[model samples]
Target: MGRNTRKRRSPLATKVVAGAAALAVGGGGLVWANFYASAHESDSSHHRTRSAGAQVATIQCPDVGQKLRNVPRGARPGVDKELARLDEQITEAYARLASTRQAQSGDSAYVQNAILGPLKSKRTAALDRIGINIRRGGGDAPGGLDRFAECRGMGADQPGNGDGDGDNGNGNGGQDQDNGQGQDGGQDGGGQDDGQNQGDNGNGAAGPFADDFVDINDVQPNSRDLENGLAANGDGGSTGSFTAVCGVNENNLFNSDNLIVAPGVDNGAHHTHDYVGNQNNNAFSSDDDLAGADTSCQNQGDKSTYYWPVLRLQDGTQEFDANDLGGGAEGNVGKILKATEAEIKFVGNQQSDVVAMPKFLRIITGDAKAFTNGVANANSSFSCTGFEDRQVTDKYVLCPEGSQVVRTSNFQSCWDGQNIDSANHRDHVAFVQQDGSCANGFQAIPQLQVRLVYDVPAPTVENGQVQNPYAVDGFPEQLHKPITDHNDFINVMDENLMNEVVDCINGGEDCQ
Candidate 1:
């Protein structure tokens, strides 16, 4: 077992959070350094080729680059080798489809294919859970750009929230009341400061994402920061989070187009519980306060992707685990990790100090940072406070020192905010933005990866498996659904670029 972490014994107060902050400590502040929390995992490991819900050590994830506290890296990191391994597994899956087909008579075979055409089919169910995509034919070529677009969708092109005469309160340009910087146009507000988080063992090992694009010698892959955001830590439970450090940019060492989305179905994938089981103490101890929470939150996909991924310094210094900080739902930008479908409360299951955001379409080449500072560092739009415990989403700019942006939240969106709840914050979409934090000469916007404190709910079958949409006459599983624009208003994706069977039942318009 690794050395256990202690929640207390810390220092370097960044900002004095209210008593109700989600990860709140007693002293009206978020400890920035000297945080030692001893955490224990009670679950035992099982063998015999586990499926999605298996208790395994940090073994399944592929390493990107992991080392102990700034130690130099070896010739290869784990991620590269795993990608190669994944390629082999996916290929084998394709071959399995053919062999399985041989064992059946014409009708049985036809029935089998008709029933389980895609990886989601009963016949191929096991294969899909193991990260394999076995369709009637095969997957699209790896890293195919157009296909990638179909899955991730363009950011700026997305239609605004459909409310009223285009003036319904969807985040728009109205000088959004800059507290420090603007809302990054993409990011929401509600957050805090960090000092003890990454400064733990020096090397400034805080978050899972590192800024090696500038130095390349500063990457640290293995550390506490990396361990927390991983699924292996969940003891086979579905709450663990994944972070990955792919070569999104050669010069910057970040991904500009990366996205991660949460499934909204109750008990959907990436389910989690938020802010559960925390005693109000005056001191801040990282005692897994958010663990065991009775809530979870799921959001729209393709916004930003933040899995716990590790990195190695160009100088060869090792850091956190490769899979510990970075690795998640196959880069789909919509797969779930830490979420509970039914109740939409956000949880803290992921590990890492600062939630890192990439400059839009541009990864950081140097000084990779999560920016525009201030209370914007907190998650969601609100925090909790007081004996009655009212929640408030206090939007403040860390860089400005004064409140430039000041937006509050209703309980409908967030749970609470900015109060002395000691492990209490609201559960809502982010409300802050990044202004002037982009890397020079990159893309039009900033790409982001947040190290979420996942507290997800268990995964549930959608529609009780009432229908297997993948089954169709004369259609490949990959070609079942056609992403047609609905009267140029609502639209859906084609199967080759889709995951679930489109609910063509209602045409999705819910006409009043």
Candidate 2:
């Protein structure tokens, strides 16, 4: 009887001690859960103790984890691991949380105000560690930016160019730190800057966190052809003669502004034109021998020189029969150089075509047509009747500077001459003001207003995308012209800043 009592008492004592241990562990875990949430909130501190505490709370002790496996809270097996594995992960997560908190929490004015950024290795490293801990703890995975597949050792997500908008739900202009981070530890600090920089009339942002930085809208490509030489100037392809300068037409001469009326002036030893059409128009009279080219065509008081980009408001043009090689000509070149509807509309968009007006605002300002002697004009005839009318009416003003191809009634269609404030008046101020190349006397279009915009990359449509990036040359010296080649245009875009205009109608950033 004595032995039986002693055995029963010993077993009861063991059970009581185990029960007490279990209760203590559960209560401590409850305390630790609170610690986890608090540490996450006040993570800006360098609290080593807090980190160590977090490490212990997160550890997945297999003994506890397996026993609780059937429990609702343990369904994820979120922390199931042997003692060693549990310890490793807990330490890692805590260290990472500590590092990231320290990096972003730094308070420096220079760090806040830099154009590029507070570009600190510490910040980068911190972001990396946090991302690593998240992945290790099995948080949500980045969708296409698969960190495992693309990220290098000790890196974050690696998204491409257009991915800047992804995961940034608020459009706050800051990239998802884990999205664009690359192999080399956030080397390119350009993540914060918009695609284009220094807009002509843009709100200069202090930095990424500023209120008003948006996409650029008027970026133009700079070409070698702008300053030193024009594109294929000497080629039989178009503008001028191959081996010599040709005598220019006197009747159709103009200045860069297209508004100049050159007063009486000498032709400077070279044979000047009696009346020649613009290279863009291809109605040029090339029968005369080549002569020295007039170097200065933009000055206001020169008679020998006229204006450039000689725009004509043509409601109807018969010469388009010949120039529309795609429509009337027999050569395959026409088929190859076929201008699609997208290209046309893209040009119109860049020129800010009045959406309310007839889409006849065919934005033909920068369009070019090469004169292929026989192959081009084979079945078509030039507008002799139109030329005859010009000869008699406006004193034979051959392609008269600032002339209209519009029907007499449609003359007003080009531009509303009086309402300078009209949105349809063309935003030409950005051209000269931003370009920094001209004086105020840009020869004004007689009855219509001309708004000049620089950086119109010769418009093109390939692969269903309209690649007309109008870039502003921020170069200190002379501002360059548009990059015409498709590859070159894309290359410049991939490298430099460009304009992004929001469609007033659509209200979305327009980038190509």
Winning candidate number (TM-score): 1
The 10-residue segment with the lowest total lDDT in model 1: 481-490
Instruction: Work out the TM-score per prediction.
Output: 0.18, 0.14
lDDT of 2: 0.17
Q: lDDT of each model, Cα atoms only?
A: 0.17, 0.17
Which runs of model 1 end up more than 4 angstroms from their true locations?
A: 1-370, 373-512
Residue 61 CA displacement from its true place in model 1, Å = 34
Instruction: Provide the lDDT at 259 for model 2.
Output: 11
Q: Which digits, one per residue and each the tens of the lDDT, describe model 2 over residues 118-185?
A: 22222333334433443565564223222211111110111222211121110112211121111222
How well is each residue in 303-422 modelled by candidate 1, as lDDT tens digits?
121211111111112211111101111111111222111111111111111121221111111000011111222112211111112111212111112212111111111111221111
| Model 2 alpha-carbon drift over 4 Å, by segment | 1-221, 224-362, 367-512
State residue 371's C-alpha deviation in candidate 2, in Å.
6.5
RMSD of each: 26.9, 33.4
